[model samples]
Target: MKKISIKIVYKTLLVSTLLTTFSCKKVFDVKPQDQVDITNNYRNVYDANAAVIGIYGQFQTLADRYIILNELRADLMSPTANADQYLRQLNEHAETTDNPWADPRPFYKIILNCNDAMANFDKMVADGRMTSSDYQQRYSDVGAIRSWLYLQLGIQFGSVPYVTDPLTSIDDLKDASKFPKISFDQLLTNLIAFMGDGKRYLDVYSTSVSTTGATNTSLNTTVDGYATNLFFINKRCLLGDLYLWHGDYKLASAQYHYVCELGSLSTNGSWLYDQYLVQNGDGNNHVDIYYGNSTDERTLVDNNNGGWRAIFGGGVGTLTGQEWIWSIPFDKNFLPQDPFVNLFSNTGGSYLLTTSQLALDNWNSQTQQNGLPYDARKLISVRTINGQPVIMKQLYYNVDATSFLPTSVLQKQGRWLLYRGATNMLHFAEAACNDATLGTSGVKLAYALTNVGVTRVYDNTWPAASSLPTDRTNIEQTFLDAPYNLDGRNGETPYYRGLWYRQVGSRTRAYLQPLPAALASDKLGMETAIIDEDGLELAFEGQRWGDLMRVALRRKDPAFLADKVYNKLLRDGNGNAAAVRTKLMNTANWYMPFKL
Candidate 1:
């Protein structure tokens, strides 16, 4: 099924007038609200489940705005010629209160929905319609969602109103100071506490699907019966992420290690990783796990257009269970338009570009093998259409190449990935690097973590379909077969290699994308190794800006941010790089100012 068709019992409700009022003033003034009948909705577990689905639905509504706010503020993408004035302002870091994209209403709306779900779910438990354990699980789930929303709001908007209660009447809004705005640090503190609650009730394990009768090829090929478990937030992933944001390296590493180790286990009880290979006509190879593999049952024309692909191109249960930890699913029936396609697809109109040297240099690495000297992620990550590169990883359905118009099939809907194994692996590596107690083990873990993603690139060509290359020496030799290898990094045995040999055409600082020569004098000589790895492993996935923020904040150096973004703009050849840099260097420009 392209969408999870659980018939939601409660209607999708938004306190639209309240949201508007909240956005317009520091103190919310509301008229007496009319009492609406709502008691019937929480009478049973089934209805409570429907309320949970509605929470997920609220996330769906925030998806496009999420990507826009996160990505545009970073340097990974450029405003297209078709970009509206508001987009141009955002891309240039000149956004003010008037920019619609900077509005905090969306985040508040999701938080409001979470508030309602929590209140109603509590009632369900009190009424004995839901078990206590189930109630705890539901609370944990909703809390994680709410915490994440606040974290993002804190990231984009420096401080935001922290409202936890559902406003049913004007009385709830009367206390202006009750909704005190909190800082990002405070927000992280609250988020960590919320995810701690999640850890107590949520299981790290996902339920593998067993029943299967659908004729759709993808559904038939599912590794498990159903993968509904991957849709909601997992405690380990959320905890790890929240801890990382809080700079609690040891705790973050622990959480990330749990997710990475768990991700290695198969839901269907097979190999450690969900691995697949697709051989191109030229005998070149690409990993299906990276670009996403579609079986005969799960193609653009089919009903089963989901799995991890749902995080990008919409479809929920596409893959049974592999790398994707959590995602938001969208269907055209519900959203009316696929925002990803609307923004990046050819048939749709937009002018975002990834043609910068930073993007191209990484694309040229030998390890990212879509083809020799061209990482497989190149074409998939950013497609060069009409001699310009635009983001393409999320576009995976029926679209005319020339026209770039996506069909209205539910398959064309894109998903939003909250967390994945690759990102977690890198997170563990970085967190371990920051942790002193791990000692030598931390170094090895860091090396292994880097290899985990790099290996996926070259592992595609090992030429053995019957077995995974378990031999460390054999894996090293296969990678060494390439045109270039950093000879000194290869230790005595394949298992001991801590430094990977550099590939041809790759810069020394390529892995940890160094600042351009213009900013080299700034002496932030520090390559953001983990952030670089994240770019290669999860580009255009909407984490680039967050990665930048993590580094800048961790070191207490706005120089890192000023250098990376400003230097890119200075070299952008747009003739206005200086003007953009002026706006971006303000530090205040780094975050969206809150209105109301």
Candidate 2:
């Protein structure tokens, strides 16, 4: 199947922007009913296609804010000279209502677009202009996208007003009390419901127009052109993520396992990819995940060439990696341009920067000092320039290895890969570990070793599969004694009989990063191990803060939340460690308060 390129057009008509930052002065210029040409605009399949593309366009605009707020607020990133006041404030955990990135407007705007597209297409179907299957496909696509946006909102802000219908009038905002604030748990429930409907309407296997019996014969003929596009959001992937967040471990595992199962199939359809996305030196590492081993116009890198950097911005021109299940598309010459490439790349105008010791020390400890071989992630994720650590995760433009590129070139190539294969695999591991009823120490350890120990460990010197102990006490003790084992990148010697990530680093430095509060005192070593692995595997991907929040909230450990940030402050000493620790220790500080 051929991949579709997302070309953004900025001729969208805003339905209602009253009392919001994105609201235009012309909000009243267009009539409530005639806000957009819904009746006339969606008359043809081409027009309907334009509307769907516009929905993805909204995601492009959201790329910068999504990354900035999620990452800058975490311990992994701190502000540099390029940072503005708003950026600095966010790093300091002092968010204001006026902070543009913190505002929920972008999320709501995308939801409104989804609502508009779905409603107009429904009318078209009712009028016999569109087919029933076509309507189902479009409805499914829009619902899943909306649910994805809602999940982000719920994660950032605890209780937000759940708006299902489009707001057509200023009166809708007049009565704030009418809008009910949905809790994070309740929001996940609603999102699950949305995923259910989306899955029912979407096809597991892509079909041609003749096979689908669709009225839009021109576009729906191939799996690539179908309205229920596999590239936008995979229903099972979305469902699995939702299940994981909802604490339904068995259900989450089932969904992720299904994805993994499909990857192993020889004749799998468009819904699942067949190869691993990123790999280490040896092909044995991170095996059996989804990816594209071949190269075409859609993707620039092939099996022999690409790894993490290639999958992201290994100087590849296209965002067509098979591992990318869902992503916000970018056009270098469009209204909503990409920002990450420049933000991380531009040494001339750097906005976000790497913390001095957190990443560098981590790289040294694991790659050089540790008995295991060097991890490839360190080379791809961070590099030291003029004795300062800088992030190199998503630099799209070309640059010399030691120096930062100019921002102008960086902005021209900003692209964001939202979801990938490794993300799904790790989620599966986490779900298994956290599963209350179905989880056991052996099961969790097995899942962890499969994803991290065997697949991601660089030296491939992880303990033999037969050596891992089945008992929980033995596993805990094995980790506590990991630092003493000195087998370096060689499987010849019998070593620690437990998970590969048993001893991440010395106790003093590693504790600066948060430990999962849910872990027992005996299993606390695993907390630092998980945090280290997550940092290395998913670094510069906008997940650090949320990961900390999840563990902190679940364990209710103030020290866990305070330690990482406080340690950073003590190193820099710009802010008072006691004040910052006090603020973060408070559970409320974990999330940005709802500010519409």
Candidate 3:
């Protein structure tokens, strides 16, 4: 049977049994059924590995879903067509009344499963069935995943429960009324300590940490393939993330840099530094692994109306570039489609391109750096259908024959994007090219904090040129300086949280949207946590929303950018995507409903 069906059945069983909450008391009290017997399952490494892998798979889905709350909590997007209204209440920017699940029910399920697995795993070690080395790794893997999830929860909910012991009954698990809560800082501090312990174990286990980074396809494909670890990427990702939450930027940077170095390491001990690659084969280009070969890989369409082909408001997306330090590789298992066609997509209404102030500013600023052509690395190209050439963006060939644009190409509606075909967006956005005349028209913001809320306008006039620094760190910092919402530095003060919303594509800040009496103070009155949260939460996700309260606690009020982005493109599903559509229509979107 298809894993899809199995997944469906799993969810059905779980949801039915867990309407309000999974009652651990109920699980222990119920009659046992045909569950996989763990004793025999532990004899060999194969099944044991699979078990660990299973933990990883469950972790991936929920973990992926869990992060969305942070995005919502930080005002990255408002609840629209898809998320439960309860979730929308937590957007933090909004004057929310309440919801219960936000208390941490579902995510805990994932945590419990991991812990349960760890328990069984530790038993295997105690019996001498497994080596101490294996045992240590298992501990680290659990710590990594659990730490990650808990940290996210802490950030999303100021105080959340810190559950280490798996429940005696699976039934007692779901009763939200019975769950405990902890302060965000406390939970974070505790997890940090746990990770520190796990790190000591990890150090003694491996001869030396094998730091090779992973591409998206690999991690997504083997969603639960880690027994000792969920592959190096997650491990690397965890370590890097851990250091950041601990307020150890230098260590955090080192952790990420360590992975980057491992990725570049050669057998001879030399390093293969970044190779500057641009989309050159077609007018529209991207840096992506465009296909996957796994029988269970994520394909373009789930149904006739499903698939990447159906999601395009413009063209579907493609991956191609230096933007990704390390991504899933393009192999038989991934990179299934022709990346070029998807490049021309318009990503639903996001392609309207009227008020994306931040992108415009970043592009112009980056381009002007080092006296390079005023055009930033993100180029615009337009070509003829018959392999002919012309001034790109000329109205004649503009629509379908273009290249990279901006973040406004997608908007949230249940899922931020809803694209399907790679070609649907081909002919859109042709109207604006070097649109020196582009103004803040159709910039219909539903609400703003004061005036425009947070926003930034780009004049399109190339910035004053400066010399390019050869140092990679310097280059990264330069990109960091762009006045756009990013995820690495401080950003959470009310002022910072409201920055992007305030800059609604006008040089003049936005007008005020009435504040609720409940709101503590004016946005500007806030500290810089807004900037810090933005830097951390939206670091690579193509976003800038920061869970400001976390910032209020972390830095204690005032915050500023020191740094985030979201899904700009994808080559496959779960690190393994279907073939790239060479002849499909397109519409583009940023997110999809639950992978199922």
Best by TM-score: 2
* Candidate 3 per-residue C-alpha lDDT over 358-430 given as tens digits, one digit per residue, 9 for 90 to 100: 3323334322212343221122222233332211111111122223222232221111121111101010111
Error of 1 at 95 (Å): 0.8
Clashes of each: 21, 2, 138
Count of backbone collisions within predicted model 2? 2
Worst 10 residues of 3 by lDDT: 420-429
The CA root-mean-square deviation of candidate 3, after full C-alpha superposition on the true structure, stands at: 18.2
Q: Candidate 2 at residue 77, lDDT?
A: 70
lDDT of each: 0.53, 0.53, 0.31
| Candidate 2 per-residue C-alpha lDDT over 95-139 given as tens digits, one digit per residue, 9 for 90 to 100 | 888988788876877776777677777788889767776677667
| Residue pairs that clash (backbone atoms under 3 angstroms), model 2 | 209-221, 286-455
**Residues 87-145, candidate 1, lDDT per residue (tens digit)?**
87776777878888888866676676678778877777887777776677667777778
lDDT of 3 at 80: 28
TM of each candidate vs. truth: 0.71, 0.73, 0.46
